[model samples]
Each structure stands twice: as structure tokens, then as C-alpha cells.
Target: MTLTIEELRAGVPKHSRKMITQNVVEVLNQLSSDHGEDFAEHYKQNLMSMSTVLKSGTYNMKDYMNAVKFSAFRLMDHSDVDSYMLAFPERYQRLMLKYADYGDEQSIRADKISSFVTAYKKNEIVAKVTEQALIPSRILNAPMFQTALNIQMSIAMSSRSDQVRSQAAESVMKYTMSPEVQKIELEVGVKGQDEIMALRTEMHRLASQQQGTIMSGTNTSLEIAEQVILHEIEDHDDIDISGELG
Candidate 1:
């Protein structure tokens, strides 16, 4: 049985995803050569929007044709991005820059750990971090410390968060994100407990539902591949347009 990240990952085996990605790229370039660079770029960009890989967020297989998946996969296996960078820097420049930006963002996140800093002052970072956390905890006034933790999870390097914060985030994620876990809120009186429990359940359920709804909109990378490949074959007929194009 293949370890699954999400539903769309079912058809493709885990190991071959990269080779498929490289094939996709090769086909993309070939299409470009056959058609015109203009057509190629438009085709690639359309696929890219489908492949949309965000620099922030927990590494999940959400987007289509996202090279970031390969980048993350490569890093997890080798614990380094150097080989990936050197092997196909131009082809995977987005992932390279993304990995690089992760480091840069980590530095920024680490520096803003001070209590004096406000999430409002750093809105972009805070927003990205919150989205990455995948926790829709309501905050009438989100304090710096909480948002700081969110930021750490969003873009910080694995080592950036000390053991305590790491454990806290892990615990939160483990309980909050798990389907088996009861998301009841702890309260004092029986009435309060019941109300809070109901509310927490609703919120947690809604968050999960919202997440599922979002994921459903995602088109598989192969969808893009099919459209591009078909356009290339039917429209260009493998004819070289490198001269007229460039």
C-alpha cells in the first residue's frame, strides 16, 4: 500500500512522481520547440497556475504539476537541496528559489520572535503563516506570541523552532487535525462545557469541511499535461518553430 498524502495522489506511485514531473517538463519544452516560445510560455504558465506551489504552507500535495513537491521530496530524502539545484536549476528554478525563500523567510520569522512585534505590523508574513498552520482558530485580537508560533510553523526551518515550540505545534496539529480526536473545548460548568464543546465541534468540523472543499477544486497535474500535450500534438504536429519563434 502506498502512503497517501491526499486523494489525487492515488494513481501515481510515490517514487515515480519525480520522473513523471521531469517527463512533464521535457514534454513542455518539446511543445515549446515544436510550437513557438510564445505558445510554450503561455502553455507553461497555464500549467504553472495549476501547478501553483506556495512558498509557505505545510508541505502537502495540493497543487497540480507543482515542482515544489519534487523539491520537498528530494530534500526529505537527501536532506539537502544542492543536488536538486545543480541538476536542473533552470527547469526547477521556482522550487530552487522557493527553497531559498524558505530559508530567507525562516530568518525573518526567527528574528520577529520578540514579544514587541505585532502581527498587524507584519501582515503578509502572519497571513501566510496562519494559512500554513491550517488552523482556523478564531482570534478577536491575535497576539504576537500566537502569531509568532504560526509564522514559525509556516516558513521556519525545522531547526528554527526550539523543542518546546515544536512539541506544542506538534501536539496541536496532532489533536486538532486528526479525524479520531474529539475537538471538545475544556470548560468549567456542565452548561458551559456543553456549549463550548458544541461550538468547538462546529468550528472544527467547519474548518475540516472548508479544507476539503478547497482541496476538491485542485486539478491534478496530469490534467494540465493532457491539455498541453494534446495542444502540442494536434496544433504543432511536432514541427520545429525554433527559428520563427526565437
Candidate 2:
């Protein structure tokens, strides 16, 4: 049976889900284009099975590579193997010699087949497939995320209870609205008498500077009043004037 991308993504961790799912989809598309749809379908099934095992977090990279290699081998026909060996005779001969230590003919043949499959995985196309198969899927997609907002909208439009409808509408609005940018205000206070006195002296100097500007008609009375009030608020112990205006 064919597994959807959504189903495949269910087995993946949230952090890597999107990246892995996208890569898997691309690899599957490439497979379908290179081979037939039937071959790609079988490969996808194998990938799904591997993904299921992956959810347990028990499988290692070697197990994953072997799984993909065997999956491709299972789909290979005699003609396919013959074509591969013809294409890479030296590699196949090397693999056969590598497995010659096995005692019986059947044992040697089985070992040769296993080694051949492993070596086959190094081919460019097969390497791409194996790399993608190792990654898990995504947890959420755009459609699924939008579903919650859609439900809220429906409730807001058609609910029987007016209060419930209002609440739902408010919720929908809350979700749809762009978040307000928060403004942070930090206030540093002077608790020591020495620090307070130093601040008072600075405020007096600033006020004197402003007085000359006021006399010269460069500064307004209201501006001077605001500056004095701000300084007074800073000097006071019980008052807090550090916050956003709105």
C-alpha cells in the first residue's frame, strides 16, 4: 500500500520533520521519473516500513542503509542484475572474491549477494534513495495548522449560542491578527544616598541648561514642565514612571 507524505511524517521528530519530508518527496519523484511508477511505489512502501521502525529510536545508520539496499534488491529482476554486473564487472568480481572464504557454495553465494547489494547502494541513484530513506517525516503541514482557525471561524459564523459564537469570533480574530510588537522599558534606580545625590546634581545642571533655552524662547514651558516631572519621578522612592504609554 502507498503511504502519504503525512503518514510518513508522523514517525519523524518535530525538529527535522520539514526538511526530511521535503527531501523524501523529491527523491520519490526522482525515482518515479527514472524508473516506473510501480518501482517507486514499492520503494515508498519500504521507506514507510523503515520509518515505522525509526519511530522507536532503536535503529542505527547501518540498519537503515541495509534496509534500503535490500529494498532495492527485492525489486531487481534477473535482467536488472545482469545489466548491473555488465556495467560494473570489476566491482562484482571483487565482491565475489571477497565472499570466497565461505565454506559451501550456497553460503558463498549468499555472502556474495549480500556484499553485492551493499556495493550496489554506492551507486549515485541508489545512494540518493538510501540517504532520503534514513530521514523521518514532518509533524505538521499548512493545511493541518489552518484547520484550527477554520473551526473557530465556523463556530463564530453558525453557533447556536450567542456567547459561544462571540467567543469563537474573538478567538478567530485573535488568531488572524498580526501580533502586536511588544515594547520593553527598563528602569534603573539609585538606592544609595551618594548615587541619588549625584543624580540630583546632574538633574540641576540639566535644568539650568534648559532654563537658558527657555529664556531664549527655544524651549516651551510645557517641555520644561515635562522634563522637571520626569526628573522628580526618577528621584522619588515610591513612584514608578517606567512603562509604555499605551
Candidate 3:
């Protein structure tokens, strides 16, 4: 299922909610430095204020604003942004369906593991680490670490709390299994797991160094942020348009 703008509004806080004009403008203004104040300001003043900008209605207030937010976020880390966008009600409903598919995969994996475990319990001496392939082969193959990292990175940036950051790291280790599976993933054209992990660690280190830095905004520590975001774009080949764009 796909998400619509109206549903996105439902997920955002009420106080944070403003007229369509304000919210869209503010998001554009926030992105001004990267995209150019002139580009954002021009779109805000001319195109966005129009009555026929969205299909939902003639005076498309909320829905138009939602579309803008969706499109704008897509130009950032699109995959990550898409995941967050799924929090909207329409997307959330669709997510429930996807969850069923995941449940099926888990059930199959679990059944295989149960058989393996039962066999192992009967003859412990004969069991090898290879015998427990179902768990790591199935569940661990998912992008569990990437998902946790996304949550933790958002929390760390927004909260600026070390405790939250630590919890995020712990959550990654908890959900993601051993480095053994990471090797398999890398071998399957997933790119460098070690590099990604190191990249996250170093980004965290730089963030910690800049005690007064804000999250969800421009990275003021130029050199480090440039390196990190560039590498991120390279690995993901997604929405990040740092050096490659300009």
C-alpha cells in the first residue's frame, strides 16, 4: 500500500501542525542552504501557493502541503525517508499487510530452526554451528542493522542525548546477529558492512566532538560530515546528493 499526504498529516503532531503554507514554507526554508534559498523561495512564493497544485481538491491546502513534504523528503535519503513516511496512517495500514509476509518468512525459518534444534538436542555431540543456518540465513539477512541505525541516528540527532545514542548502538547489536552473517551479505553485493559500520561510528564520533551541534540540520563540521554523507550516498546510491550533484 502507498501513503497519501492526508495520512502524513495524521502522523505529525498537532502543535507542530500549521497551515499548509507555513509547514511547506518552513520545510523549504530549512532546506534552503543546500538547494539554494532562491530555488526554495521561488517555489514557495509562486508554485506552492497556487490553488490547483494538488489533485485532492481545488483549494488543496493540507494535501498539497503533504505532497510537497513527501517529494522534498524523497530528495534526501529517499529510502530512509520512505521508511519514516510509512508512519502515516495510509502507509501504516499497508505496512500491516507487509508484516504478514514477514510473519510467513519468520514462520518458515522458525520451523526449520525447530527441526534443527530438536535434532541437536537428541545428539548434541554431532551438531555443528552450520546446523543452525535457518536463523542467520533468513532473519539476519534482512536489513535489521540499517533499520536500527536509522532510528538511533534520528533519536541521537533530535534528542542530543548520549543515553539515547548508546541505546541505539545496543539496539543494533541486539537485533542484528553475528558478523558472520554480515560477511555473507557483503559477498552478495550488499557493499561493505565493515565500511558502513565504521562510517556510522566515525559520524557518531564527530557528532560527539561537536558538543553544541544540532541534529536534523546541516552538518557544521564540514570535513567530517562531507566524508560521511558522501560515503553514505555512494553505498546506498539513493537520495543523498552531496559532491556528486554539484
Question: Which candidate leads in TM-score?
Answer: 2
Q: Write the per-residue lDDT of candidate 3 for residues 139-177, one digit (tens) a residue.
A: 453454455456665544444444554455456545544
Model 2 is weakest, by summed lDDT over 10 consecutive residues, at 237-246
Better of 1 and 2 by TM-score: 2
Evaluate candidate 3 by giving its C-alpha RMSD to the native, one decimal: 23.4
Clash pairs (backbone) in predicted model 3: none
RMSD of each: 26.1, 24.1, 23.4
What's the distance in Å from true for residue 238, model 1?
A: 54
User: Where does candidate 2 clash, by residue pair?
Assistant: 9-137, 9-138
Global Cα lDDT for candidate 3: 0.40
Better of 1 and 2 by lDDT: 2
TM-score of every candidate: 0.19, 0.28, 0.27
- The prediction achieving the highest lDDT against the true structure is 2
- Which regions of candidate 2 deviate over 4 angstroms? 1-21, 58-66, 75-246
lDDT of each: 0.35, 0.49, 0.40
Ranking by TM-score: 2, 3, 1
lDDT string for model 1 (192-217, tens) is: 44543444344344334434444586
